[model samples]
Target: MATRRFPTREELRVWRDFIETGELVRSAMAARLQKDGLSPGDYTVLLALSEAPGERLRSSELATAVGWERSRLSHHLGRMEKRGLIRREECLTDNRGAEAVLAPAGRAIFQQVNRPHLRDIREIFVDALTPAQLEAAGEIMAALREHLTRE
Candidate 1:
C-alpha cells in the first residue's frame, strides 16, 4: 500500500489554531446576536431574504442562499413565521413550490441588529488584525476557496 502524507507537525499546529480561533469568533458573534433574539440561522435567512429582489426568494433559493438544507430552512421558517418575522406564500411561478418573503418586522429587526453585528465583527475580528494582516487573511481565504472549488 502506498503511504499517504499527513500534515507535518507545524502544519497541524497551524490548522488547530485556525480552527479554534474561528470557532471563538463565531461563538462571540452568536452571543451578541442572541441579545436581539436572533440565532445565526435566523439572521442568515433574514439576510438572504433582505437581499433578494422584491425582498423575497423561492424556498429552494433561500435554502441555497443560506447554505442550509430544505428541512432545516422549513423548520426555522416555521418559528420565524410564528414570531411574525417572515411570511411564506405559494410560489407564484411554480404551483408546487413556495416563496419566503421578508416581513416588515423582519426587515425592521434586521436593520436594528445589523449595526451591532458590524460592531461585533469589528471587535472580534477586524480590530485584532493589522492592515497588512487583514489583507493577508483575505488572500488566504480566497486561496482556500479557490482550492476547494477546484477539488
Candidate 2:
C-alpha cells in the first residue's frame, strides 16, 4: 500500500495566509473605489491612459499594455464608453484599429480617485516596506510576471 503524503503545516499555512490576505486587501480596495465611482478595472484603464503622452492609446496597444486579452478589454471598453468615460476614435492609419481616448469624464473621475488610491496603496501595501524591500518586491513581481507568461 502506498502512503498518502500531505502538505507540511508551514506550506498549508503559507498558502492559506496568502489567499486570505489577498482577498481582504482586494475587498478593501474595491470598497475604496466604490467612491470616486470606479471599479478596479476602470481605474486601471484610466491610469494606463493617463500616463500616455496623448492620454490615448490604440485599443490593442492598451490591451497589451495592461496584459489584458482583446475580448476582455473590448468588453470593458464598451462599458466605459457607455459611461461616457472614454471614446473609441477610429484610427485613420489603420482602419481596423481604434484608439481608447480618455474622455473628460474619465479624467475627472481619475482625479477624484487618484489620491485616495495612493493613500490606500501606501496603507495596505507600501508603508510596511523599506525602500530596499520595495525594490526587491518590484524585482520579484517582475520575475513572477515574466515566469507566468513564459508558457
- RMSD, model 1, all Cα superposed? 2.6
**By TM-score, who's the top model here?**
1
Off by over 4 Å in 1: 1-4
Q: What C-alpha lDDT, on a 0 to 100 scale, does residue 85 get in candidate 2?
A: 98
Error of 1 at 23 (Å): 0.9
Off by over 4 Å in 2: 1-6, 128-151
Tens digits of per-residue lDDT, candidate 2, 12-125, equal 998798689879989888888887678999998999999987999999999999989999999999999999999999988999999999999999999888998999999988
Write model 1 residue lDDT over 1-151, tens digit each, in one string. 5765898799999999999999988888899999999998889998899889999999999988888899999999999999999999998778999998999999999999988888888998999999999999999999999999999
18, model 1: CA deviation in Å? Answer: 1.3
The C-alpha lDDT values of all candidates are 0.93, 0.92
User: What would you estimate as the lDDT of candidate 2?
Assistant: 0.92
Model 2 weakest 10-residue run by lDDT: 1-10
